[model samples]
Target: MSWARIMAPLSGGEGDATALAAAVRLAEPFGAEVAGVYTPADVADVMPWMGEGFLGGVQTTALESLKEAAAAGEAKAREAMSHVTYGKNAFVSLQTPVWSGLSAESRLSDVIVFNGDSARGRGPLAEAFQQMVADEQRPVLVARGEFSVGGPIAVAWDGGKEASRAARLALPLLEKASRVVILAAPKASSRTFDPTRLQAYYAARGVTAEIDILPDSGDAAPLLLYAAGKVGAEILVAGAFGHPRLQEFIFGGTTRSLLAAEAPTLFLSH
Candidate 1:
């Protein structure tokens, strides 16, 4: 499989540069288009709170302030995109209804990119990240600390549907890796499956992978991280497991642990 477009949602925050850089790095190998999408705050969302007959100066000033902030954010996002000097790049400034535009762009793109802050729910694009991964079920690459492409990559597999989908969607990236390792803990879970099945699957696609069966452990995140580090992997491909609760996502144990750790770049799909 080949990736044609990579979407990076820029929030005009500290994470924009990391997200854009990672997008460019991924796009360089396949000559994919790096779409730098600027998601500004939507002013329409606050209109209902102001009441119906509240077209007074207070509302006017609030609206103006929102507009000015949006304008400034767009400018910052554009400046961040200008620094990316690899592959095809496009700067897109979303309109007032920014969420809809972001969803549309993410659906059309092959994979979405975010930085660690956004992925960890500590940035302006945190909601966007959650929406794309949990609601839209889009693949995302959480770039952290100088992401490197074409390096040793690791895949976390458990023979589940979610893991299978993540492995399949990450085929394009796996093809570019210098080495691929599949980390599986067969005894850690209740599921009975073969890790070799994934190995054979990759082999059939002209991608050779080594399987590392981890020992029985209560948690799989630490083992996966250690194994990835042992192999000097710069990227880890895994499935994101989470459920929606009151418009927020409650991630699975392993997924949450991985997100909290300072590990490799994560390529995840829900």
Candidate 2:
């Protein structure tokens, strides 16, 4: 498996630069195209609030304001993308139906990239991040501080479908890592499984991986994080387990803990 294209959603905010830089780093090794997509606010979404009885002048002014905001955002996104000179790059500006445009772009790409702000639900692209992982079910890379693709990588295994999917989707990346380690805590969960299954799977794909059976702990996130740090892993591959609950996405305990942590880039799939 190979990654041919990477999609990075840019909100023209503080996280845009980090997210774009991470995408470029991931793309360089695979010779993949890095698409910096500018996500703009859809004017149509606000039109309903104007009410049917609103005056024409008021509506026109509101529309103009929205257009101006979008233009400024697009300019900022372009500026952020301009710094990427390492690999193939493209600048994409979403249309009126911004969400649909983003979804389409994500479907066509191999993986989606987001910054720490988006991953922590603290920025303009937070909702977009949730939608991609939960609704779109696409592979996503949450780029944290100083993300590097040349370092060691750790894979969290739970013998679940989600983990299996994540491992499969992350094959291309794992194949390129300096070292790959599989971290599993079978005694922590009710499910009985072996981590060597994953090791064999990776071996079949020509990737050598070491297995680490963590001590039984009530919570698996801490163990996984500790092991990843011990191994000096630059990235942790795991399945994002979450479902939409009304307005928010409720993530599984381990997934939540990992997302809330401050270090190690996350490569996740739902």
**For model 2, what is the error of residue 244's alpha carbon versus the real structure, in angstroms, after optimal superposition?**
6.4
User: For residues 34-141, could you state the per-residue lDDT of candidate 1 as single tens digits?
Assistant: 999999889878988998987899899999999999999888999898888874999999996888988999999999999888888887888998899888999999
lDDT of 2 at 18: 88
Q: State the C-alpha lDDT per candidate.
A: 0.88, 0.89
How many clashes in each structure?
Answer: 0, 0
Name the top TM-score candidate: 1
Q: Where does model 1 exceed 4 Å of error?
A: 242-252
What digit string (tens of lDDT, one per residue) describes model 2 on residues 1-270? 789999999988778888888998999888999999999888878878997876588788988998998999999999999988865999999997999999999999999999887888887898999899888999999998886776799999888877889999999999888999999999887788889999999999999999999998998999999999999999999988732334234444777788999989999998
Q: What C-alpha lDDT does candidate 1 achieve relative to the native structure?
A: 0.88
The parts of candidate 2 lying over 4 Å away from their true place are: 53-59, 242-252
